[model samples]
Target: MPSIIKCLSYTLPSNVYTNEDYYSNFPDVKSVNMEKIGVKQRHVITQGQTASDLAQLAAEKLFLEHSIDRNMIDFLIVSILEHDYYTPSTACVLHGKLGLQKKCGALDFDLGCSAYVYGLGLADGVMKSMGAKNVLLLTTSVLTKTFHPKDRNSHFVFGDAGTATLLTLSEKENLGPFVFGTDGSGFEKIIIRDGGTRNPLDKNSENELKDEFGNITSNANFAMDGIGVFNFSLKTVPTMIEELLTKASLTQNDIDLFVFHQPNKFLNETLRKKMNIPEPKFVHCLENTGNTVAGTIPIALYESIANGRLKPGMTVVLAGFGVGLSWAATIARF
Candidate 1:
């Protein structure tokens, strides 16, 4: 493993959407299962704010709070489910925003829940193949704006967030032995049907359609097939975990903590029970932030560290699963 995380930091916009606010804003909020999602409140960006803004703030906080030397960062990788533009990579935008050394390399990629794990794997690869000494990995999701106005199915489940993780090449391994999977067939289970080259936004893109349950969205908005995603997770996550454990040569009992993407309380709790993983070892951090897509795992892990739950010298398993029907898991020593 050539990558070791030096610091982790995250930021959320100021706008808070508590359950109370939801009921007040949408009288039909009861149609959405509030308890199952296990979210008390979520922070969403106000109008005109972008995911890159949160990421920039998070990265600035990372540097200032941790006393990180910006000059030493050699590569920057930004992972997002949504981007600020179609041409320029968000990483390049951040490179300019952060004022990093001109020699630094920058790139961006889009992934959903499994993004943090993918970013880590890429960081390690760059350190090994490109000789990047320091890699700045930023994961962000700004999904609130993606929901169609009347979409009850997803409008409540997602919050906006940005996370920054600084990693450096090291002699001893602190991250590695990852198992990744993709189910392109289930792509529609969670997707934004328009705005891509495959389905460019048009006048009809915003035409709202209501489902049988009265939930509404349009081709222009991001959406998810909840039951489909739930079933997909239940089917795929266990096998992925077993493979990850085997690849790392570690048993269930060997892991000190299990950090998975915070999709929802019901779905995650169901997975935990199905896997027979002990309650205390599993991390459940979605009480306040809701599902932040790519930002979930890192934000949860960072919060656990702050709360003294994921202490140093602990052996942890980090797993992320969701949109693209994608999944990834890896064992790490913290």
Candidate 2:
């Protein structure tokens, strides 16, 4: 059994936060590079939206536009950094909210930027082994809630969104040959320190502290090692791409499009130049979407198809890197 991505859909809240909003709030942080990050605005969850809600919305869109029958879906895999509850998986919540069949299996996985690629691999294996026909892979992120309002290192770079990609068994496989890498040593590079079991939230966790860069954040908020992340991408992404190409027995030129995690404009452009890939062969959709963590790659894919950059039967190389210090690359035929 092989998996083919039949459709891609995404949803973002209507609330818009512009770069000027960040600048207005942190007047002292004049040196923050908004242009380099390539995001002028981002959609943010209003007061009540959760990651599951966004995922459901995206799935609804897929069902409507593609005329997919939800009752036929056999498995649901959701990738998200935050969950509505610690006990129940977000996938289960989505399954129920969408009124999916009771026979459907659901699971949630914790991952960041690399999640979409990982989800595809998981879906393919599940479809083959379980003899299932349809697997719905959902990746959602509401990272803005994790960020401290004044944390210049991460606030402007993240956005809130969710994506749904329908993977179904087909005579021809459109996905495969994934290469994955992880470096736990860099786990602290991007983390939310106070909410988990190890560092259970306390009153002290709310104490605000300012970094050398004049950014303010509390222990309960998300923090990032910007330099460490940048260096890691510079070192690992190229090698990952090369390894993926080698594993798939293909050359760089054989790929019609390269869709990597959209961390920031500068990092993505840097990776493209480093890979020696032409601008037209790469997909860049971060100008409006920002980096939506697990949702980045799928969102990029949706935009690519909409803008005519991606076409049916085209060979595409998808890669994602970040958060778990994890990276993955795979080849897919559209």
Candidate 3:
């Protein structure tokens, strides 16, 4: 018996923001069911809300439900594509918010999409040898507040939410092997063009241009080559999962549940069909919370376990891909 996912919980803002109603400002809103895309209405943060605020809410919920003694937790890891501030990691803010004093180690990892598996691996290692019995992993994506409302391509798809998962060394559970991959060359395939040191806001104005649709287009704004990302996912995800299972000496049949990142309803369905996985084993949470970046899979897992869709002793496969052109997979025994 080693470290296992003892329990997990997640939360999202109560508001829902979508381009569907802003027909005048954004003309591309369609009638398609948001659920069809793996999200119905995504939670929207209220004005002045920050990523840390959402994360705090989720962490508090998990903390209260488990009644975990904050001092017993040894490490805190925060993963986010966007943070509330450029300085002092969001995890540090969460530490102060929770008032968990004791100079517990805090780290911030800048990753998009494939972070849970990566973070879980790091947490598992820390809890085993750090003289700590528990570790807290929190992830949040507040892309909704970052993207301009006029940008229809990204506005309707991205959502804001936060999730927390507890990992601890326990005697009554099982944990599985992990497999990870990255292709930095395709990093530009899905990215936000501006706001980084490479292309700071101080750059010349002429370098930017507007699209034919009159939308101010820049490398800084979020632009995703949908077709390219889709092809990358469908072609690479199955192989990644296969290799993960192989390392664990398991197979598709050995897994009772398949929890992949909620990229989109259409893409998930396509990959599911390609992998020949039955619908019953797949977990989809796009309806209520849209694509929550790093928050998607964990939130879905938390909901499933809470609703009894996931039970103890069940074998589950977790995979995540997107942003950073990165992908990761790991098998877990629930």
Candidate 4:
């Protein structure tokens, strides 16, 4: 028994887009360094859909294919910063959708890119502590729903998707020495100016945002200081990975694949260059799916396992950063 990923599944919205399509609508859109990112396309969820719907779809697939009884799941965690509603918790909504209403304890976390790794760490700790057998950790984020079409930076780069990972107890060793950290001081680097308690879409607030043409984009839209985000990400992500390797008592040579939050092609390349990490081991899926926010790591993991980039008994390093001014990394033998 391996307390590792027993089975993993992903559900990407049945829509696609290209750089040309994204850039033509907004000329100022910073060009995605497609070649470097190794993503030729990405899936985009349609309008009028919420993150919970995507998570449920993916979870259903996981259960049906694996024949997992929903009731056996003792805990269900939905890792995401964006939720269908702030009060109900996306985990509860997903539990109902999956019909795990009775035995499951559900909750949502407000983590962005780092959600998947953090979710894995959290799930592992709780499951072992409580003597549970199985835990389903699901993550979904529709970056497009919060994206303003006029916001070139995010609109061109952010795609929508959901992923589900089933973690179970093992007779062997569990995933070891996870490395996670946060820096709230730079929280504004990736800020959604409106729609939260800080700037709720209410009359008491004076929230406003304008597009490149100087027209008001919308009262509710996401905003990021791209330069600050890029600088922070490039610096923090590689260092975290190194720390994770150290904790595992391993070095860069021990990793078989490196999966990271699909932020963008430029950032990935820059980080690799600065850290001297091998190019072939760096896994990214930005072109096809853009940045799926918190969903990228698992989605990329599925792709890697499917396409033979990863195999059984291989050591994979997972790292994610962004949005909460957060970052996390972990090394797993699959």
The residue-by-residue lDDT of candidate 3 on 196-299, one tens digit each, is 87766645522545556455545656667777899999988999988998898887898899999988889999999999999999887777777888998898
Best by lDDT: 2
Q: lDDT of each model, Cα atoms only?
A: 0.88, 0.89, 0.80, 0.79
Better of 1 and 3 by TM-score: 1
**Model 2 lDDT tens row, 1-334:** 8888889999999998888886787666654556778898889988988888899999999999899999999999999878888878778888999999999999999889899999999999999898878999999899898777668767788889989999988887679799999999999998888988899999899889887767778889988878889999999999999999998889998999999999998998998998899999998888887899989899999999998889998999999999989999899998
Candidate 3 regions with alpha-carbon error over 4 angstroms: 18-28, 32-35, 203-217
Residue 21 of model 1 has an lDDT of 74
| Tens digits of lDDT, candidate 4, 242-284 | 7888788898888888888888877887887788878888886
> TM-score for every candidate vs. truth?
0.97, 0.97, 0.91, 0.90
Q: How many residue pairs clash in each candidate?
A: 0, 0, 8, 5
Go through the candidates in order and give the C-alpha RMSD of each one to the true structure.
1.3, 1.3, 2.5, 2.8
Query: Which model is ahead, 1 or 2, in terms of lDDT?
Result: 2
Q: Which consecutive 10 residues in model 1 have the weakest lDDT in total?
A: 24-33
